[model samples]
Target: MEPTRLNKYLVDAGVCSRREADRLMEEGRITVDGRRAVLGQKVTGNEKIFVDRKPVKKPESIERVYIAYHKPVGIICTSDPKAKDNIIEAVNYPDGRIFHIGRLDVASSGLILLTNDGDIVNAILRAEGQHEKEYIVKVDKDITDEMVTSLRNGVHIGDDRPTLPAKIMKMGARMFSITIVEGRNRQIRRMCEAVGLNVESLKRIRVMGIKLDDIPPGKWRFLTEQETSALKAALV
Candidate 1:
Protein backbone atom coordinates (compact mmCIF):
# COMPACT_ATOMS: atom_id res chain seq x y z
CA MET A 1 0.00 0.00 0.00
CA GLU A 2 1.12 3.56 -0.64
CA PRO A 3 2.37 5.45 2.39
CA THR A 4 -0.19 7.71 4.07
CA ARG A 5 0.27 10.88 6.07
CA LEU A 6 0.42 9.99 9.74
CA ASN A 7 -2.36 12.39 10.56
CA LYS A 8 -4.62 10.95 7.87
CA TYR A 9 -3.78 7.44 8.99
CA LEU A 10 -4.77 8.29 12.54
CA VAL A 11 -7.97 9.87 11.28
CA ASP A 12 -8.81 6.75 9.27
CA ALA A 13 -8.10 4.60 12.33
CA GLY A 14 -10.68 6.51 14.37
CA VAL A 15 -7.97 7.68 16.73
CA CYS A 16 -8.44 11.42 16.17
CA SER A 17 -8.73 14.12 13.54
CA ARG A 18 -5.77 15.33 11.51
CA ARG A 19 -5.30 18.44 13.67
CA GLU A 20 -5.51 16.41 16.86
CA ALA A 21 -3.08 13.86 15.46
CA ASP A 22 -0.62 16.67 14.85
CA ARG A 23 -1.05 17.85 18.43
CA LEU A 24 -0.50 14.32 19.68
CA MET A 25 2.69 14.12 17.66
CA GLU A 26 3.87 17.43 19.05
CA GLU A 27 3.11 16.24 22.56
CA GLY A 28 5.13 13.05 21.94
CA ARG A 29 2.09 10.91 22.58
CA ILE A 30 2.23 9.11 19.22
CA THR A 31 4.88 6.53 18.46
CA VAL A 32 5.66 4.83 15.14
CA ASP A 33 7.30 1.48 15.64
CA GLY A 34 8.40 2.46 19.15
CA ARG A 35 9.85 5.81 18.05
CA ARG A 36 8.20 9.18 18.62
CA ALA A 37 6.28 10.13 15.47
CA VAL A 38 7.36 13.27 13.64
CA LEU A 39 5.04 15.96 12.38
CA GLY A 40 4.04 15.32 8.74
CA GLN A 41 5.49 11.83 8.75
CA LYS A 42 3.98 9.08 6.63
CA VAL A 43 3.27 5.43 7.38
CA THR A 44 2.74 2.39 5.16
CA GLY A 45 0.21 0.68 7.48
CA ASN A 46 2.73 -2.04 8.22
CA GLU A 47 4.67 -0.42 11.05
CA LYS A 48 3.27 -0.65 14.55
CA ILE A 49 1.56 2.57 15.65
CA PHE A 50 0.57 3.63 19.12
CA VAL A 51 -1.16 6.65 20.54
CA ASP A 52 -0.37 7.33 24.19
CA ARG A 53 1.12 3.84 24.43
CA LYS A 54 -2.02 2.06 23.23
CA PRO A 55 -1.72 0.18 19.95
CA VAL A 56 -3.79 1.62 17.15
CA LYS A 57 -5.91 -0.59 14.94
CA LYS A 58 -5.63 -0.53 11.17
CA PRO A 59 -7.81 2.07 9.48
CA GLU A 60 -9.90 -0.49 7.56
CA SER A 61 -10.93 -2.13 10.81
CA ILE A 62 -12.57 0.94 12.32
CA GLU A 63 -16.37 1.21 12.52
CA ARG A 64 -17.67 4.76 12.33
CA VAL A 65 -20.08 6.12 14.92
CA TYR A 66 -21.64 9.55 15.25
CA ILE A 67 -24.14 10.98 17.71
CA ALA A 68 -25.42 14.28 19.01
CA TYR A 69 -25.28 14.70 22.76
CA HIS A 70 -26.79 17.28 25.08
CA LYS A 71 -24.02 17.83 27.54
CA PRO A 72 -24.98 19.09 31.00
CA VAL A 73 -23.09 21.49 33.23
CA GLY A 74 -20.13 19.97 35.13
CA ILE A 75 -19.46 17.30 32.54
CA ILE A 76 -15.94 17.86 31.25
CA CYS A 77 -15.32 17.40 27.49
CA THR A 78 -12.39 15.13 27.77
CA SER A 79 -11.74 11.47 26.98
CA ASP A 80 -9.20 10.99 29.75
CA PRO A 81 -10.76 8.44 32.09
CA LYS A 82 -8.69 9.85 34.94
CA ALA A 83 -10.29 13.27 34.71
CA LYS A 84 -13.07 14.01 37.17
CA ASP A 85 -16.55 14.30 35.65
CA ASN A 86 -15.23 13.21 32.29
CA ILE A 87 -17.67 13.10 29.38
CA ILE A 88 -16.83 9.48 28.52
CA GLU A 89 -18.13 8.24 31.84
CA ALA A 90 -21.15 10.51 31.68
CA VAL A 91 -22.19 9.21 28.26
CA ASN A 92 -20.98 5.63 28.73
CA TYR A 93 -21.48 4.91 25.04
CA PRO A 94 -21.75 1.14 24.68
CA ASP A 95 -20.69 0.80 21.07
CA GLY A 96 -16.98 1.63 21.25
CA ARG A 97 -14.40 4.40 21.72
CA ILE A 98 -15.51 7.83 20.59
CA PHE A 99 -14.35 11.41 21.12
CA HIS A 100 -16.07 14.78 21.20
CA ILE A 101 -15.88 17.00 18.12
CA GLY A 102 -15.29 20.17 20.14
CA ARG A 103 -15.68 21.40 23.68
CA LEU A 104 -18.03 23.31 25.93
CA ASP A 105 -16.66 24.62 29.21
CA VAL A 106 -17.59 22.73 32.36
CA ALA A 107 -19.85 25.54 33.52
CA SER A 108 -21.64 25.58 30.17
CA SER A 109 -23.87 22.94 28.60
CA GLY A 110 -25.74 21.86 25.46
CA LEU A 111 -25.27 20.26 22.06
CA ILE A 112 -22.03 18.44 21.35
CA LEU A 113 -21.10 15.88 18.69
CA LEU A 114 -19.32 12.66 19.51
CA THR A 115 -17.92 10.41 16.83
CA ASN A 116 -15.41 7.79 15.83
CA ASP A 117 -15.21 9.29 12.33
CA GLY A 118 -12.30 11.71 12.45
CA ASP A 119 -12.77 12.78 8.85
CA ILE A 120 -16.10 14.39 9.68
CA VAL A 121 -14.62 15.95 12.79
CA ASN A 122 -11.86 17.52 10.72
CA ALA A 123 -14.28 18.85 8.12
CA ILE A 124 -16.58 20.47 10.69
CA LEU A 125 -13.73 22.02 12.63
CA ARG A 126 -11.64 23.26 9.73
CA ALA A 127 -10.77 26.90 10.43
CA GLU A 128 -11.96 28.06 7.04
CA GLY A 129 -15.10 25.93 7.23
CA GLN A 130 -16.70 28.68 9.35
CA HIS A 131 -19.39 26.32 10.56
CA GLU A 132 -21.93 28.14 12.69
CA LYS A 133 -22.60 27.22 16.31
CA GLU A 134 -25.52 28.97 17.98
CA TYR A 135 -25.84 29.55 21.70
CA ILE A 136 -28.27 31.06 24.18
CA VAL A 137 -26.47 33.05 26.81
CA LYS A 138 -27.67 34.76 29.98
CA VAL A 139 -25.51 37.43 31.51
CA ASP A 140 -25.45 38.95 34.95
CA LYS A 141 -26.97 42.24 33.79
CA ASP A 142 -29.38 43.51 31.18
CA ILE A 143 -28.33 43.42 27.55
CA THR A 144 -27.47 46.83 26.16
CA ASP A 145 -27.21 48.44 22.76
CA GLU A 146 -23.53 49.18 23.29
CA MET A 147 -22.86 45.58 24.28
CA VAL A 148 -24.64 44.32 21.20
CA THR A 149 -22.72 46.68 18.95
CA SER A 150 -19.36 45.70 20.39
CA LEU A 151 -20.04 42.00 20.12
CA ARG A 152 -21.46 42.25 16.62
CA ASN A 153 -18.48 44.33 15.56
CA GLY A 154 -15.99 41.88 17.04
CA VAL A 155 -14.03 42.10 20.28
CA HIS A 156 -10.45 41.34 21.19
CA ILE A 157 -10.66 38.30 23.45
CA GLY A 158 -6.94 38.37 24.40
CA ASP A 159 -6.13 36.32 21.33
CA ASP A 160 -3.59 37.40 18.72
CA ARG A 161 -6.54 38.55 16.65
CA PRO A 162 -9.96 39.89 17.49
CA THR A 163 -12.87 37.49 17.12
CA LEU A 164 -14.80 37.45 13.87
CA PRO A 165 -17.97 39.52 13.90
CA ALA A 166 -20.81 37.46 15.34
CA LYS A 167 -24.56 37.31 14.76
CA ILE A 168 -26.40 38.53 17.83
CA MET A 169 -29.98 39.11 18.87
CA LYS A 170 -31.28 40.29 22.20
CA MET A 171 -33.75 37.72 23.46
CA GLY A 172 -34.46 39.30 26.83
CA ALA A 173 -33.17 41.88 29.27
CA ARG A 174 -30.53 39.49 30.54
CA MET A 175 -30.45 36.97 27.74
CA PHE A 176 -29.50 36.86 24.08
CA SER A 177 -28.69 34.50 21.24
CA ILE A 178 -25.33 34.47 19.49
CA THR A 179 -24.03 32.64 16.45
CA ILE A 180 -20.32 32.32 15.86
CA VAL A 181 -18.21 30.54 13.28
CA GLU A 182 -15.08 30.06 15.31
CA GLY A 183 -14.48 27.93 18.38
CA ARG A 184 -12.01 29.35 20.84
CA ASN A 185 -11.47 28.39 24.43
CA ARG A 186 -14.39 29.77 26.43
CA GLN A 187 -14.91 32.13 23.54
CA ILE A 188 -18.48 33.20 24.25
CA ARG A 189 -17.66 33.91 27.89
CA ARG A 190 -14.50 35.78 26.99
CA MET A 191 -16.34 37.78 24.37
CA CYS A 192 -18.91 38.83 26.95
CA GLU A 193 -16.15 39.69 29.39
CA ALA A 194 -14.50 41.86 26.78
CA VAL A 195 -17.74 43.82 26.48
CA GLY A 196 -18.00 44.26 30.28
CA LEU A 197 -20.59 41.51 30.74
CA ASN A 198 -20.43 38.35 32.82
CA VAL A 199 -22.07 35.18 31.55
CA GLU A 200 -24.32 33.61 34.17
CA SER A 201 -25.31 30.74 31.94
CA LEU A 202 -24.50 29.44 28.46
CA LYS A 203 -25.93 26.66 26.33
CA ARG A 204 -25.29 25.71 22.76
CA ILE A 205 -28.49 25.23 20.80
CA ARG A 206 -27.26 24.38 17.32
CA VAL A 207 -24.33 23.40 15.14
CA MET A 208 -24.74 24.16 11.49
CA GLY A 209 -28.29 22.79 10.96
CA ILE A 210 -28.23 20.27 13.83
CA LYS A 211 -30.55 21.57 16.51
CA LEU A 212 -30.50 20.68 20.19
CA ASP A 213 -34.27 20.67 20.04
CA ASP A 214 -36.00 18.30 22.46
CA ILE A 215 -32.76 16.57 23.49
CA PRO A 216 -33.15 16.76 27.24
CA PRO A 217 -30.04 17.63 29.17
CA GLY A 218 -27.85 14.56 29.74
CA LYS A 219 -29.37 12.68 26.85
CA TRP A 220 -28.26 11.96 23.26
CA ARG A 221 -29.46 10.55 20.00
CA PHE A 222 -27.92 9.28 16.79
CA LEU A 223 -28.07 11.63 13.84
CA THR A 224 -30.86 10.78 11.45
CA GLU A 225 -29.92 9.65 7.94
CA GLN A 226 -31.25 12.88 6.51
CA GLU A 227 -29.47 15.00 9.10
CA THR A 228 -26.17 13.21 8.50
CA SER A 229 -26.53 13.47 4.74
CA ALA A 230 -27.26 17.18 4.93
CA LEU A 231 -24.31 17.79 7.21
CA LYS A 232 -21.89 16.00 4.90
CA ALA A 233 -23.35 17.81 1.92
CA ALA A 234 -22.74 21.14 3.60
CA LEU A 235 -19.14 20.19 4.25
CA VAL A 236 -18.66 19.26 0.65
Candidate 2:
Protein backbone atom coordinates (compact mmCIF):
# COMPACT_ATOMS: atom_id res chain seq x y z
CA MET A 1 0.00 0.00 0.00
CA GLU A 2 1.20 3.55 -0.73
CA PRO A 3 1.55 6.24 1.91
CA THR A 4 -1.82 7.59 3.10
CA ARG A 5 -2.91 10.42 5.38
CA LEU A 6 -3.28 9.30 8.97
CA ASN A 7 -6.86 10.45 9.28
CA LYS A 8 -7.90 8.84 6.01
CA TYR A 9 -6.26 5.61 7.10
CA LEU A 10 -8.24 5.62 10.33
CA VAL A 11 -11.47 6.25 8.46
CA ASP A 12 -10.75 3.40 6.05
CA ALA A 13 -10.07 1.16 9.05
CA GLY A 14 -13.67 1.63 10.23
CA VAL A 15 -12.43 3.13 13.50
CA CYS A 16 -13.81 6.64 12.92
CA SER A 17 -14.03 9.48 10.42
CA ARG A 18 -11.12 11.64 9.36
CA ARG A 19 -12.10 14.50 11.64
CA GLU A 20 -12.44 12.21 14.64
CA ALA A 21 -9.17 10.56 13.73
CA ASP A 22 -7.51 13.95 13.81
CA ARG A 23 -8.94 14.50 17.27
CA LEU A 24 -7.61 11.18 18.43
CA MET A 25 -4.21 11.97 17.03
CA GLU A 26 -4.20 15.35 18.77
CA GLU A 27 -5.11 13.70 22.03
CA GLY A 28 -2.00 11.50 21.75
CA ARG A 29 -3.98 8.26 21.55
CA ILE A 30 -2.63 7.38 18.15
CA THR A 31 0.95 6.34 17.28
CA VAL A 32 2.89 5.20 14.25
CA ASP A 33 6.05 3.09 14.41
CA GLY A 34 6.10 3.33 18.22
CA ARG A 35 6.00 7.15 18.18
CA ARG A 36 3.06 9.49 18.89
CA ALA A 37 1.22 10.14 15.66
CA VAL A 38 0.84 13.71 14.46
CA LEU A 39 -1.91 15.23 12.42
CA GLY A 40 -1.37 14.71 8.66
CA GLN A 41 1.30 12.06 9.24
CA LYS A 42 1.31 9.57 6.40
CA VAL A 43 1.52 5.79 6.61
CA THR A 44 2.28 3.23 3.96
CA GLY A 45 -0.34 0.93 5.57
CA ASN A 46 2.61 -1.37 6.29
CA GLU A 47 4.06 0.33 9.36
CA LYS A 48 2.90 -0.46 12.87
CA ILE A 49 -0.01 1.73 13.96
CA PHE A 50 -1.87 1.73 17.19
CA VAL A 51 -4.92 3.51 18.55
CA ASP A 52 -5.19 3.69 22.30
CA ARG A 53 -2.49 1.04 22.53
CA LYS A 54 -4.30 -1.52 20.36
CA PRO A 55 -2.78 -2.38 17.01
CA VAL A 56 -4.59 -1.01 13.94
CA LYS A 57 -4.65 -2.61 10.51
CA LYS A 58 -6.10 -1.00 7.46
CA PRO A 59 -8.56 -3.17 5.51
CA GLU A 60 -7.20 -4.26 2.12
CA SER A 61 -10.04 -2.31 0.61
CA ILE A 62 -13.43 -1.24 1.87
CA GLU A 63 -16.62 -1.33 -0.11
CA ARG A 64 -18.72 1.66 0.79
CA VAL A 65 -21.85 0.01 2.20
CA TYR A 66 -24.97 1.68 3.46
CA ILE A 67 -28.02 -0.17 4.74
CA ALA A 68 -31.30 0.78 6.32
CA TYR A 69 -31.94 -1.97 8.83
CA HIS A 70 -35.07 -2.83 10.77
CA LYS A 71 -33.48 -3.43 14.13
CA PRO A 72 -35.42 -5.76 16.38
CA VAL A 73 -35.75 -5.32 20.11
CA GLY A 74 -32.93 -6.97 22.09
CA ILE A 75 -30.29 -6.51 19.39
CA ILE A 76 -27.44 -4.36 20.61
CA CYS A 77 -25.94 -1.81 18.21
CA THR A 78 -22.26 -2.50 18.66
CA SER A 79 -19.32 -3.96 16.79
CA ASP A 80 -18.24 -6.13 19.71
CA PRO A 81 -18.12 -9.75 18.68
CA LYS A 82 -18.81 -10.87 22.23
CA ALA A 83 -22.09 -8.99 22.15
CA LYS A 84 -23.51 -12.09 20.43
CA ASP A 85 -26.73 -10.28 19.46
CA ASN A 86 -25.33 -7.10 17.96
CA ILE A 87 -26.83 -5.40 14.94
CA ILE A 88 -24.00 -6.68 12.70
CA GLU A 89 -24.79 -10.26 13.65
CA ALA A 90 -28.50 -9.66 13.16
CA VAL A 91 -28.04 -8.33 9.65
CA ASN A 92 -25.46 -11.00 8.82
CA TYR A 93 -24.04 -9.05 5.89
CA PRO A 94 -21.40 -11.15 4.10
CA ASP A 95 -19.50 -8.15 2.85
CA GLY A 96 -16.96 -6.00 4.70
CA ARG A 97 -17.25 -4.56 8.21
CA ILE A 98 -19.81 -1.84 8.88
CA PHE A 99 -20.87 0.13 11.91
CA HIS A 100 -24.14 1.61 13.12
CA ILE A 101 -24.44 5.29 12.30
CA GLY A 102 -26.11 5.98 15.62
CA ARG A 103 -27.79 3.87 18.23
CA LEU A 104 -31.08 2.46 19.44
CA ASP A 105 -31.53 0.97 22.86
CA VAL A 106 -31.66 -2.81 23.19
CA ALA A 107 -35.28 -2.63 24.29
CA SER A 108 -36.32 -0.44 21.36
CA SER A 109 -36.59 -1.39 17.71
CA GLY A 110 -36.95 0.10 14.23
CA LEU A 111 -34.92 1.80 11.51
CA ILE A 112 -31.17 2.13 12.13
CA LEU A 113 -28.52 3.12 9.63
CA LEU A 114 -25.59 0.73 9.20
CA THR A 115 -22.66 1.55 7.05
CA ASN A 116 -18.95 1.15 6.36
CA ASP A 117 -18.62 4.71 5.10
CA GLY A 118 -17.05 6.45 8.08
CA ASP A 119 -17.26 9.77 6.29
CA ILE A 120 -21.05 9.66 6.16
CA VAL A 121 -21.30 8.59 9.78
CA ASN A 122 -19.33 11.60 10.94
CA ALA A 123 -21.07 13.96 8.57
CA ILE A 124 -24.62 13.04 9.59
CA LEU A 125 -23.92 12.88 13.31
CA ARG A 126 -21.80 16.01 13.44
CA ALA A 127 -24.38 17.92 11.42
CA GLU A 128 -26.41 18.08 14.66
CA GLY A 129 -29.88 19.61 14.17
CA GLN A 130 -29.58 19.32 10.41
CA HIS A 131 -31.48 16.00 10.29
CA GLU A 132 -34.53 14.55 11.97
CA LYS A 133 -35.32 11.08 13.27
CA GLU A 134 -38.92 9.98 13.67
CA TYR A 135 -40.27 7.48 16.13
CA ILE A 136 -43.60 6.15 17.36
CA VAL A 137 -43.69 5.61 21.08
CA LYS A 138 -46.33 3.98 23.25
CA VAL A 139 -46.52 4.86 26.90
CA ASP A 140 -47.72 2.71 29.78
CA LYS A 141 -50.97 4.71 29.91
CA ASP A 142 -52.87 7.47 28.21
CA ILE A 143 -51.05 10.80 28.37
CA THR A 144 -52.48 13.90 29.98
CA ASP A 145 -52.78 17.26 28.26
CA GLU A 146 -50.27 18.85 30.66
CA MET A 147 -47.77 16.08 29.96
CA VAL A 148 -48.26 16.47 26.22
CA THR A 149 -47.72 20.19 26.46
CA SER A 150 -44.54 19.80 28.51
CA LEU A 151 -43.22 17.15 26.15
CA ARG A 152 -43.98 19.30 23.14
CA ASN A 153 -42.42 22.32 24.80
CA GLY A 154 -39.22 20.40 25.56
CA VAL A 155 -38.10 19.06 28.90
CA HIS A 156 -34.87 18.61 30.86
CA ILE A 157 -33.72 15.09 30.12
CA GLY A 158 -31.30 12.62 31.70
CA ASP A 159 -28.38 14.86 30.86
CA ASP A 160 -30.18 17.64 32.74
CA ARG A 161 -30.11 19.63 29.54
CA PRO A 162 -33.20 21.06 27.92
CA THR A 163 -34.32 19.13 24.88
CA LEU A 164 -35.03 20.72 21.56
CA PRO A 165 -38.72 21.27 20.84
CA ALA A 166 -39.88 18.23 18.92
CA LYS A 167 -42.70 17.82 16.43
CA ILE A 168 -45.10 15.50 18.17
CA MET A 169 -48.49 14.19 17.16
CA LYS A 170 -50.82 11.97 19.08
CA MET A 171 -51.48 8.81 17.04
CA GLY A 172 -53.79 6.96 19.40
CA ALA A 173 -55.02 6.83 22.97
CA ARG A 174 -51.64 5.64 24.20
CA MET A 175 -49.32 6.23 21.27
CA PHE A 176 -47.72 9.27 19.69
CA SER A 177 -45.25 10.06 16.92
CA ILE A 178 -42.31 12.36 17.55
CA THR A 179 -39.68 13.80 15.27
CA ILE A 180 -36.49 15.02 16.91
CA VAL A 181 -33.25 16.34 15.50
CA GLU A 182 -31.07 15.42 18.44
CA GLY A 183 -29.81 11.85 18.98
CA ARG A 184 -29.36 11.78 22.74
CA ASN A 185 -29.29 8.33 24.25
CA ARG A 186 -32.85 7.36 25.24
CA GLN A 187 -33.93 10.92 24.62
CA ILE A 188 -37.54 9.94 23.95
CA ARG A 189 -37.75 7.88 27.10
CA ARG A 190 -36.16 10.63 29.15
CA MET A 191 -38.44 13.24 27.63
CA CYS A 192 -41.51 11.14 28.43
CA GLU A 193 -40.34 10.48 31.97
CA ALA A 194 -39.90 14.19 32.50
CA VAL A 195 -43.55 14.58 31.64
CA GLY A 196 -44.63 11.76 33.96
CA LEU A 197 -45.04 9.06 31.33
CA ASN A 198 -43.55 5.58 31.11
CA VAL A 199 -42.38 4.39 27.71
CA GLU A 200 -44.06 1.04 27.07
CA SER A 201 -42.47 0.68 23.66
CA LEU A 202 -40.34 2.67 21.27
CA LYS A 203 -39.65 2.12 17.59
CA ARG A 204 -38.02 4.45 15.13
CA ILE A 205 -39.50 4.53 11.62
CA ARG A 206 -37.53 7.21 9.88
CA VAL A 207 -34.25 9.08 9.83
CA MET A 208 -34.14 12.14 7.66
CA GLY A 209 -35.80 10.95 4.39
CA ILE A 210 -35.17 7.22 4.82
CA LYS A 211 -38.06 5.10 6.03
CA LEU A 212 -38.19 1.62 7.51
CA ASP A 213 -41.12 0.79 5.24
CA ASP A 214 -42.19 -2.88 5.32
CA ILE A 215 -38.73 -4.33 5.95
CA PRO A 216 -39.23 -7.02 8.55
CA PRO A 217 -37.39 -6.82 11.86
CA GLY A 218 -33.87 -8.30 11.76
CA LYS A 219 -33.62 -7.83 7.99
CA TRP A 220 -31.72 -5.24 5.99
CA ARG A 221 -31.20 -4.08 2.42
CA PHE A 222 -28.85 -1.77 0.60
CA LEU A 223 -30.11 1.75 0.20
CA THR A 224 -31.15 2.76 -3.30
CA GLU A 225 -28.92 5.29 -5.00
CA GLN A 226 -31.64 7.90 -4.62
CA GLU A 227 -31.86 7.18 -0.93
CA THR A 228 -28.08 7.28 -0.64
CA SER A 229 -27.92 10.58 -2.46
CA ALA A 230 -30.62 12.05 -0.26
CA LEU A 231 -28.71 10.99 2.84
CA LYS A 232 -25.45 12.48 1.57
CA ALA A 233 -27.21 15.68 0.58
CA ALA A 234 -28.38 16.14 4.15
CA LEU A 235 -24.74 16.29 5.21
CA VAL A 236 -24.20 19.24 2.92
Model 2, poorest ten-residue lDDT window?
Answer: 54-63
**Residues 1-236 of candidate 1: C-alpha lDDT, one tens digit per residue:** 79999999988888877887898899898999999999989999999999878899998888787899999999999876668999988988886567898899999999999988988888777744278999999999988899999999899999999999899999999999999998889999999999889999999999989999999999999999898898889988
Q: Give the TM-score of candidate 2.
A: 0.82
> For residue 34, what is the lDDT in candidate 2?
94
Q: What ranges in model 2 sit over 4 Å off? A: 1-7, 13-42, 46-60
Question: What TM-score would candidate 1 get against the native?
Answer: 0.87
lDDT of 2: 0.86
Segments of candidate 1 deviating more than 4 angstroms? 23-41, 47-55
- What tens digits encode model 2's per-residue C-alpha lDDT throughout 1-236? 78889888878887666766887788898889999999889988888888778777566556678899999999998765556798877888786556788899999999999887888887887898768899999999897778778888889986767998888899888999999999888899989888888999999999999999999988888999999998888788
The alpha-carbon deviation from the true structure for residue 229 of candidate 2, after best TM-score superposition, in angstroms, is 0.7
Question: What TM-score would each prediction reach against the true structure?
Answer: 0.87, 0.82
Question: Which clashing pairs does model 2 show?
Answer: none
